[model samples]
Target: MSYVGWMIFGVVLLVIEILTPTFFFLWFSIAAFLSGILAMFGLNLGWQVSVFAVASTLLVIFTRPIAKKIMGEAPRKVYVEELKNGVATVVQDIDSSKGTGIVKISGENWRALSVDPKKVIKKGEEVVIERIEGTTVYVRPIETEAKKEGEEI
Candidate 1:
């Protein structure tokens, strides 16, 4: 293949990579680019194809694991749906006047605040998670929530 052909192949592969982004096309795109560079240096057609296959194979074998590790889904992030209406332990007094506190929800410490602005929750209290916005968990006193649920039943 001519230099221009290799370059076009590389560009097309890159575009496919952008469209799909499953890490499948990335190696091929890099290989195609390297092959194009080799073609520009007047390498033989057979050698160009060989370089492409070898480089692509090496890239997938070596870099794919590193990419997966770096992008690994470790611990993962908790969404609002996971925490809303859940229970939490107040680790620090939640003083709405000061606008800050801490709680342990699902074994993770999170900044917390009372759902009612005037409510002040003391440390060591169990609270019901009302909602979560950003890193803050808005909560209500557990007893009150329990009472309300009991009344509803």
Candidate 2:
């Protein structure tokens, strides 16, 4: 392909990188740009192709990790300890017997289970997280002030 063709291919790859952002295509795009430069200098087809391949491979091997590290880790998971005792709103009926529930806490939804398997926490009820086992949080219904006062009376 001509220099212009290689440059357009680079632009296409850049567009793909922007759209998906897997950090896989950016190096290829850069390699294509480099190849375009070589092509502009009257390099033959074999040299242009060779430069693209070598540049792409080297950039991916050497720079992808650095780029990913600079971008930082994916959103950090909320610590289990931090979530313990935190109040959450039940978003789905928590039926421990059926093994299904969802709760919203800290602006994220999470799978939840009742601390007591026989207990069913209904949707919209408030619950306190007792513990987390893997991705599931064990929880219990938060006692209302009325219930507490009645118990005291």
lDDT of 2 at 143: 93
lDDT of 2 by residue, 108-149 (tens): 999999999999999999999999999999999999999799
TM-score of each: 0.49, 0.61
Tell me which residue pairs clash in candidate 2: none
Q: Which ten residues in a row have the lowest lDDT in candidate 1?
A: 69-78
Q: Output the worst ten-in-a-row residue range by lDDT, candidate 2.
A: 71-80
Q: How does each model score on lDDT? A: 0.90, 0.96
Query: Residue 44 of model 1: what lDDT?
Result: 99
